[model samples]
Target: MAVAAPQTSEGQPPKIKASAASLIDVGSGQIYFQKEGDKRREPASLTKIMTAILAIEKGDLKDVVTVRKRAAAVSMGQDIGLKSGDKLYLEDLLKAALMYSANDSTVAIGEHIAGEHDLFVKMMNDKAKSLGMKNTNFANTNGFHHPNHYTTANDLAILTSYALQNETFAKIVSTEEAVITWLPDEESKSVTENGEEKPLKQRTIHSTNRLLRSDYQGINGVKTGTTPRAGNCLVASAAREGRQLAVVILNSNNRWNDATRLLDYGFKEVRPVVLAEKDELVTELEVREGLEKRVSLVALERLEVYVPRIEVEKIQRKVVLTPAPEAPVKRGDKLGKMKFYLDDKELGAVDLVANQDVDRLSWFKRLFDKS
Candidate 1:
């Protein structure tokens, strides 16, 4: 299902120059602004974010992978200088792919994880479909300008939201600098010391995303991409005062500036408000043939919504129940629904459940009790 774009309570949305762009509040999964967000465009190196996340999920970070000739031959992009037969841990490759945007590292990761380039690309497409990124497809792992390889700003934002939840992926993308060691080159390995292998080669890599280097407050990172076909693209995220926001821009010359503006607008315009607290008693339900005349119902979890300050007054909660549940109701059994709404639009709903079990009244007790 697609998430609806959020509308402002007052005033017009901030203008952006990107062909496709989106801004979303992380905590509430609310879209603050969107322009052609569903339009498909090349993702460039930003595709590595998906590759990195899948690698993390499928294998151990410390697992070593031997670089293949094909992996080192990713066409039309920069590599981390991996050579055939070079061995490195998956964690190091992830650092290179994310921090340096090295296409070869991603290829190595793809091959290591899926055993073939085509299979890995298939997995990428499968994951995209599972994440509800309907407009995305993957022809290759490193995102080297294939006609079949494309994604939309909205789809990229969805992928980023899922990736950011992984602590390892978040740490790798946010890193500004990292150093990784690889096996010595053939020439270096040919000359050993005292009939033993020499030390490995270490290289330092820096992030290609400029926002992480600049003084933009709380600019944690997501990713950056550039290609002749895609122009400049970036997925950016930041956290402030326990709230986080993510921005996506595709095919924009002013991606950084536009993303910052969108983020600024979201932080200033959207405010997070608690609609209901976890286990808060909403209402009591009349029990039929239960030992207890009434049973309490409570919210399963805290419900929070992000809305414009002016629309906060319009927020409301509705409790809906089934025909009075018969006795023998177990705690945590779903009895009703608690729906949160902003004006006429429904935000979300949670199950309202019985707080404690209520047993059916005994026949003897029922017979003796005459109203």
Candidate 2:
């Protein structure tokens, strides 16, 4: 089935049935498809994605946390088998929280990080604000239903993109299954025949995201959520040939189907095209009063952008250079700018820089040349 991406001025997008959905080209930050993307709704366990990322950032993985009573008492339907007084590393707790949608584990992480779950919720909201998630708010760390707790598909997509930039967060969500070992408490570390501490017990769990295990190509991680209010929701990421896409679906009966369809459509409908390559000579401009008669201008950085596959040829390029830059120009001197547009609307721009240094002519030579 086809899912409509955002309608470009040049082409029509396909139609989709999800209540709220968004698809982005992860590499170029291009919105391929979106339907009510900014409308807020309960995110369910998908809230744990933000929780996991924060824990990874603020806590040391090796630190062992003694599970608190409140953490073990989260609202039902999910758990990491955590009990009050049980000890587990921060890393293991995060693994359980993200992969298994473990509400208890998520609470344990929140409590450990903020000394209380409510405080951690504040942190989530604060981070959301800082990340420009205007439509997002958090009332709990584990996504237990609270009318105040909500996020939008667009916000979740933004969160996923930011979290994936952290290697640790990305690695954790991408994991299909992980063996979490809980460090035994002092009470449980009774002396054996040799009087040595017993090895920690291990529990293996699989990711809640079935796309990771399915035949879907390049499926990585992200998360899935379900609640009476939110229905089935999913934030999924996939990559091919170095190009990546993130899809978010909220309140959908066919979340998996919708997410996969959006990704499949994105790869076919839009692709990244290099507008300008770094250090590639763009234009040669006359250099006034320099050792050399001319200087080559080049792009200071690579300029790659995403465009609808069919409209790649329609992109317009304009070079705007500084008016007559006098020489003794340095190799990296900013000389001008390259602006890109589609249908007269600006897409992006990059700096044009000097390709190489050009020293001024000696005084004697300058005088002789002038004569």
Candidate 3:
């Protein structure tokens, strides 16, 4: 279930200059603010976010990819200047693609992962559909402007939230700078007299998102994009005191300022409240025919809810557990869920699990007990 956007006492949301924009709570996916968030606009290099997701999930980082002719020929937008037959680790290309918005790196990654550019693009569309990005589409691996290549700020926020869940993806986007090595082309690979291969060349790539370099507190990631048709686009994310927020700005004249102001508004509107801690006991469940008649159920993870400042006192929690189960129950077995609510509306839920093992009682013991 979706949580409604919190109402702010501050009257109006921040004035965002972007043609399309959205600010979302990373944990609960609550929309804090929006400006024509569903309007379709060219994503430009921001499309690399989806490409990075597919590559990380579907391709091996250690795998070596040989740049093809098509990738080498790409000269539009920012690129690492890949040459045909040049080799690089999938990991390096990912860094270049995400941090620097390298167009050629995306093409090579798409070709390497799916063996065809169009097929990889199809995968991108399929993944978008699965993520419930109803207003998004992909026409190319690199976010070069295409007539059909477009997405909304709301959709991009959804994509970024999902991407940040992956440890590798989160790490890559938050990186301010990184160095990637690639084998030199044959023309530059001249061997020494002893026939030893020369060391691979390294290129340093810096993040295109300027907010990462700014004094903005807790600013971490995500990506930046620009093109003649797309104007300027940014997906900026930040985490502070266990609460994470992301803002998407598309076709903006001042994306950095817009993102910062919107994020500030978001942080001011809601505050994080830790309702349950990891391994903290919430309730107990009865176990039938077990050596232990009851088993303690604890929160599998921390449950921190971001509530509006005005509604913090009104928040409530509900624990729903399964009926008595016949043991042998293992530690960490999922038994039920702990749900959060605002008034009558459901906010979110977390799994409740067994805190310890519970073995079934022996038949002889059960029979004697009955007597």
Candidate 4:
């Protein structure tokens, strides 16, 4: 059966079929659009995102993990056919868990990293709390159908944004396909043409995210999930001209089209505006008892933020300068700050620094000037 497309009109949010959805600017954490954003829903395999995060932070990728009986017993959902006593690198397991949404791989990773299945689930919950995911809970390492396993679109967006900050996580999620190797049990090891035993068995895994495989421009990552209760869930991220946006959709009737339309709307609605340019002269600050009475202050770095096109003129700039200070003031010395805001929300801020040196006036010069 063909899925119905989301309804949309000019200058309005697309009426997606997702039960819960959120579109956010990755850099500024600005929410572009949301629908039932705080309503908790089953996350399905999206739980692997948090699993991958803990694995990268707590375990060495090079470490070899022996598949446990519990991991081998995971047969309910997608799996890599791992068996007890099979050995693989942690990195390979991460690839399977994330790219393939392999339920068995997540258990192995959780066991290897936390040394216990329940402990790893606890760690996932603890990490969620730290990330300010207030409406999230994890009942398992892999997002199996558990009564307690639930999260909201808002929380998932926050989690994905934090996870993307890790270079390894980002690289892994953005990958379209990967080959992972594992050491099979002695009985299952294959023999080569030359009569030598092949120590490593290779498996090629492709990302389950259809958008990533499509011709969608800037489509990067992140993950997709499905189960009876969760329906079609996806956390999709894309980058364009250095600006990244993430969309979280849970229990959607048409996840791909819904995500595509929402992302398109977001890109069209918001744009990156350069609030301040690096080294641009902001203003002059008065220096007391210095060779020069005033010192030039320039922005220390470029400040750019994504704001809705309608709110571009609403942005307010506030300059805060340090109280007049006695020289010597060296170039690059911290002098003040320039803050950009939209209404009361702070969009971005940059340090303002002295543009040149200002030495204190000599006592002789001070005395002559006094005369």
Candidate 5:
């Protein structure tokens, strides 16, 4: 594939066209590149991604949700034709909201999770803040047109990072299509306002993420959105070989094309490189007081980093040990940090914990610990 023209005099900065975008390596959990990425902008339907994540994590998929009047009132964009009292499973609503961009389904999930859209929006902000998305704010769950429902591409990426870690969230985000059928036990049969109500039968919801159906292989699920103010936005993920990566595009003329381009760049330049190995002694330091020898530290998470192949030489790692404790040591107690440096810049680091806990020296052992 053709690359964007370089931006720096050192070389080309890869010709990538996007309104606001971020490409990250999931395996390494690194933001490889960004452009207009931190600027706050309207999110539109991208809000459903977080809604899906929260629902899949906390709400029961099989539980039925009775559509409420508030949710039905949101009929501007795509909707699942929800009536005031029609019952659908949490899973179906999730698919409808995520796959079909159904505003009704989005509201259903939001209200079910927190019992109110306003309250759930608070949860969304709280969750976003917890994920370090300082530039994000939520006005509603369905991402409907609102003046204050805004977020940055980078903040959305941070939220995606947290969501992708959850298997259920990953599954829902990655799902391309779902065929939903009512449970045999659904008690109340509801009517459709369009003069027809099928008996909660099978209905298919196609994923809004066109990448799921496109040339990009190993694609996990994600969400797509568009609005007059937001244009086209997407948070897409794909796996290549063994590693996975997520790309977030906030506003683009060609959302699908931009997402694919970003992903291609990730696979080519921002390739996954192991940053740390499990059980590998990353940092070793002296023990304050212990029955055994000096304590060694290891990474809690495998140090994986994604960087441009050209920049690999620029990537250097150094293990930084915390100050030695002054007293008795216990196994598995955190004592230091393992820092991976890139071109003298700290790229990322994981906590270093005591690989093996040590027992305090007994009274007799302390006296004899002269050696």
Candidate 6:
């Protein structure tokens, strides 16, 4: 079988899947390579990722939400069989929406968060715009097919970057399966919904993400989506040897295969090398009028770098350290920044932390400290 060569026009490298995509180096906010990552495409249930985040941020998990007609309206895609007027807690609804891609759960969660479906959709678009997702829009929280509901692979990646900041949101998304049990009714005397609480046993829920399963190593929670127009999309992350990587793929025919390819590429082709370790001093700052002559400065967080191993030798790296003046500096002050560069391009920056407290110099010491 003859393998097709890359198409070229004016002596340029053949175009890869510009319509496909990936994003890596999560912490440093670096994009190794991408295809039509910014191209507008259907998000499918991956829209639930944003819905989950919004619920986490704006809705109280303990709050009660009586499923409304709109919430229980006949919808399409993944569902948890919610009925009209069904009573459930915010937490359960969130789990359902995220794990099962329940359209009802999405509507219910949206209502609970933004007080209405329309408003919740607005927030989704607003957040997308704020994240610089210039080519995205949201008409519903459930990600059902709509003429206007659209998002890009890069936009999804950006959303993941912000969504992971919420620790709880991050945990729930990555969970393989969760058993969610709640009282059929918050009160025994309360009207029964879902055929009574029935002794309140754990109802197990499994994660759609296989990476979080025991079979896979270093894989954690993220989101996945598929639609006729969007194909298969995934925003996934994994941690190995003290390094974490987030990968996003869009417009793929084979969802799992694309995810595997991107993740394998990250681990094999562009694993994050430890440019600097936590608490490792990259430089020192001279204390002008403090008890110590100098203060050690180190990276606040572990510095893991992601780059193509094939380009490892060619991947030039440099650290720019900005040390703060020592005098009157409090312990743990964010005095400076550590910037790591690869191949003349600024890859990322981490906040440099002060090693210790620097007390104000005494009158006598202040006058003679410079001497």
Candidate 3 lDDT over residue span 177-207, tens digit each:
9998987666778577899986567888898
Per-residue C-alpha lDDT of model 5 across residues 105-155, encoded as one tens digit per residue: 888788888888888888888888877888888898878778788898888
lDDT of each: 0.85, 0.84, 0.88, 0.89, 0.76, 0.71
Candidate 5's displacement at residue 133, Å, is 1.3
> What is the Cα-based TM-score of model 1?
0.80
Winner on lDDT (2 vs 4): 4
Return the TM-score for each candidate structure. Answer: 0.80, 0.80, 0.73, 0.79, 0.75, 0.69
Judge candidate 6 at residue 120 and give its lDDT: 89
Better of 4 and 5 by lDDT: 4
Q: Pick the candidate with the highest lDDT.
A: 4
lDDT value, candidate 4, whole model: 0.89
On residues 31-59, what C-alpha lDDT tens digit does candidate 4 reach at each position?
Answer: 77789999989999999999999999999
lDDT by residue for model 2 over 140-188, one digit each (tens)?
Answer: 8878889899999888888888888788888888999899887877666
RMSD of each: 5.6, 4.7, 7.4, 4.2, 6.3, 8.0
Q: Report residue 206 deviation for candidate 3 (angstroms).
A: 1.5
- Candidate 2 lDDT: 0.84
Model 5 regions more than 4 Å off: 1-13, 181-202, 272-304, 313-338, 342-345, 349-371
* True lDDT of residue 8, candidate 4: 54
Misplaced by over 4 Å in model 1 are: 1-12, 185-200, 277-302, 310-318, 326-334, 341-346, 350-371
